[model samples]
Target: MKKLLIVSLGIIGVILVLSPWILILFGRNQLHDHDIPQQEQLVDDREKHLILAIFPHPDDEVTVSGTLMKLKEEGHEIQMVCLTRGEKGKSSGIEDEVELAKLRTVEMKNAAELIGADHLHLLDYPDSGLEKVGLDSLKKIVGELIAEVDPDVLISYDSKVGLYGHPDHRLTGRAVEEVFLEKRGMDGFTPQEMFQVTLCKKQIKIALKLSSSFQKNYPEDPKQGLPRPDFSINTRKFFPRTLQVMQAHQTQQEVLKDLMPFHDKVPTWIYSRIFDREYFREVK
Candidate 1:
């Protein structure tokens, strides 16, 4: 009787442990269900320029890569600034921060290359320790990088970075905002008014609407308990390229495959865009 009781208890424990993952899988299917929508925007004739993306980790780029890929296809120079090496991710057989960071870096570079991006700058900050980094110091580093890249448009984590709410994402956002102010150049600025290419309320609202459907489908997502975001990018034109790029991150394949299984079911050219408001600050 005692042995049978022990077996029953073990099964219960296993179920409890796997409950979160099961719930997440269900939510993922819902999140990946939609076909990308088409969004039409009048393009202004201007000299081609760069769009800079600042992210806290390697995979963070995947969340917004669709828009970046679209912009690149449209001929905008794309660059990325990653803040950490993602050493904190657990390894089943491999363990060691130094080695893990190096491995992750290689993976990140490959992912970037797949998207035709040639410029990538890593800040070498400690993973999960971004909040501890002084705001002033972070601002200085990101500010200098921004000045060097000088992209026409910028993208990064939303104020409420999905699910994980990593501190690194918050700090990166703050640093980007500060850098914008410093570079606004009231005294030494060239633009005269402020940072150019700020996203307007209309654009932000459209993005937010797209994100609402994602949140509504995944109300049980522990990583993000919040409602839909207030901004999103129109992504139909670049969905295929984005999925291809996402598949390049082999280490994250299991999770990505489970969550983003649209590759087999959806049309390759389906339109879908990511949205975030944190990167939508007004420079002017």
Candidate 2:
């Protein structure tokens, strides 16, 4: 019994040490397993266009940074509106809410600049409290921004997944959807397209299987349906720039740093295979 216990402990240690690599391999395989659909690149004759992305917090922009960069490269303007400063987010150190919110604001500004966004609007809503916010009030605030931007393209989270069921994410997504639908028939307010940032259901399933830590943080919920992307943007060319944008969020590094392995530690082909695409479901 003593010998068996010793061997079990050793195996557990080894598994823990190798977990990251195992997850990477699993992710790579999962990408190959899916027959991902791609759409023809968008072409617009307009000399200048505006894209407005509404998200819940500071780091949420990273979810679509690569796609945003591609849009900017195509001579379109990109703007971001974060509903909160992430005051309730986990701190890397001993920072209080006020200190953390201030830090995140600067980090977001830097990230926006790196992504070549034309503007960023930071709405100082209370973090972790969006669910409690009045729907009409949230819609009014977002509606005002939509009116000001008159964006040609709009982006936000998918209310279905919210990529792990974060309440703020779901709330923000709902608000954006409401504003988009409400303004569609209004004169001069119809956006050409609206998309929700999302992950493939297969990818999420594989991630849950490979990382015990991820599973612990985001338990598998059969009821939490996934979004089926209407089209996927090939962002392989801009993946490096995307990483740069993510790195700019300095205070969020502890959470973001793990993403580096997809760029650095993995083979270039593997990195491209797994992360060179950003998924989006078009809102009709």
* Best TM-score among the predictions, by candidate number: 2
Local distance difference test values of all predictions, in order: 0.58, 0.77
RMSD of 2: 8.3
Task: Choose the strongest candidate by lDDT.
Answer: 2
Q: Give the Å error, residue 24, model 1.
A: 21
Residue lDDT tens for model 1, 1-284: 99999999999999988875665555433343233222332122165667787887876677667666666777777898888898886532347888878877888898788777859887698888877787788877776776676666666543444323346765676567556656665543322222112233333333345443333442244344332332334665566666777766656565454334434554343313222112222233
All candidates: TM-score: 0.63, 0.82
- Residue 21, candidate 2: alpha-carbon lDDT: 69
| Candidate no. 2 TM-score | 0.82
The true-versus-predicted C-alpha distance at residue 209 of model 1, in Å, is 19
